[model samples]
Target: MNLKRTFGAILTILGIVGVIWGAYAFLAGGDSVGGVSMNQFSSVVPFIVGLIFFFTGISLIKGTKDTA
Candidate 1:
């Protein structure tokens, strides 16, 4: 198995999951837990990180060579 390709796929999946979770959280409006406001940090951080991970994984996968 190709390590790079496998890892890239994993990363891509994780990123997609993260992005979805972030969007859900944002839409759900659950930023506050105990009188403390996250100021959208809870959602924005994951969304941004997700985007980064997604693009990085995509690039890595595209850059890697697939050899049988």
Candidate 2:
């Protein structure tokens, strides 16, 4: 497999996991830090980041497949 595809696959898997975990955290209520609930902002951040990673990885994998 091409390097791009390999990396993309890894990113895709990680992104999926991140998205699931983030959603769970957001719904279940994440841990608190200094009296502030992490679900307030932290969970959202991961979900957004996971989306980015997922899309980027898909693009990379598709682009590589087309070229190869």
Candidate 3:
């Protein structure tokens, strides 16, 4: 079992999910809390983090590949 590849796969999936959810939230608008909306923060942060996670995951997976 390749731990690096497995972990990378997991991260990649999570990143994809995060990016989708974040985009949805950003477009759909977020609910107000105490009359203060966190729409921008919630959406932007997740989208950025998701991108980071995705790139990191890809790097890990590629890094673990056996080269002939």
Best by TM-score: 1
How would you encode candidate 2's per-residue C-alpha lDDT over 1-68 as one tens digit per residue?
58999899888988897788678778766676345467646888778888888988999898885454
lDDT of 3 by residue, 1-68 (tens): 78888899999988897787677767767765345465866778878888888888999999997554
Clashing pairs in 3: none
How does candidate 2 fare on TM-score? 0.78
Clashing pairs in model 2, backbone N/Cα/C closer than 3 A: none
| lDDT of the candidates, in the order given | 0.79, 0.79, 0.79
lDDT of 1 by residue, 1-68 (tens): 88998889888998998787777667767665345354455778878888888988898899999899
> lDDT at 25 for candidate 3?
68
Question: Which residue segments of model 3 deviate by more than 4 Å?
Answer: 31-38
Evaluated at residue 60, the lDDT of candidate 1 is: 81
Error of 1 at 62 (Å): 0.7
Which whole-number lDDT from 0 to 100 does residue 16 have in model 3? 90
